[model samples]
Target: ALVYVVAGAGVLAGSGWWPTAALVAAAGGLALKAIWFDPWLSVGVLLDVGVIVAVACTWPASVY
Candidate 1:
């Protein structure tokens, strides 16, 4: 939830370390989810991975 907020702020601000923060947070959240919540095969888990990937791929172009 907090990761999503940071990611949203990063996208909106378009500068600073927010993008990297979002990327790291999202990845960490995904890892935590995998470890404690569900198997890697679950759709929710895969969605979390997708969010991490999306943040990573977009970070370079997004941050100023």
Candidate 2:
């Protein structure tokens, strides 16, 4: 959860490490949801996918 906060802040701040941090956080969140298997977590799955796609699309040629 803290990673998500850090990654989100990084993304907003245009930090060089945001893409990696975001992807890692998204993957970790998705894995956690999968292992827990709660119906309410479906939204989080979609959010994870959104984060992945967003990162892929927005990544720049040079982060810094």
Candidate 3:
């Protein structure tokens, strides 16, 4: 759901993806509002960003 998409965006962004990441994040929000019945919470965009930053900094550069 939203968490997944946000995480995916952050991961992708950390891997050098930009607009796609934004799209993913937006999509996550949209999915949360549209698909899921629980629309009271905002997607954890910051959490995903933090995850991306951490992974990017800790991991070595490699194409996988």
Best candidate according to TM-score: 2
Ranking by lDDT: 2, 1, 3
lDDT of 3: 0.52
Off by over 4 Å in 1: 39-41, 59-64
lDDT of 2 by residue, 3-33 (tens): 8899879867877797888889999999999
Task: Go through the candidates in order and give the C-alpha RMSD of each one to the true structure.
Answer: 3.2, 2.9, 7.3
Task: Please report, as a residue range, the 10-residue window in candidate 3 with the lowest summed lDDT.
Answer: 55-64
Q: Rank the candidates by TM-score, best first.
A: 2, 1, 3
Residue 2 of candidate 1: its Cα lDDT?
A: 80
Q: Point out where model 3 deviates above 4 Å.
A: 1-16, 36-64
| Tens digit of per-residue lDDT, candidate 1, span 1-64 | 6867876787787656675776677678777776787554477667767767766577456354
Q: How accurate locally, in lDDT, is each candidate?
A: 0.69, 0.85, 0.52
Weakest lDDT window of 10 consecutive positions for candidate 2: 55-64
Residues 1-64, model 3: lDDT tens digits: 5555654666665555543454555556555556664534444544445545645564434522
True-vs-predicted CA distance for residue 45, candidate 2, Å: 0.4
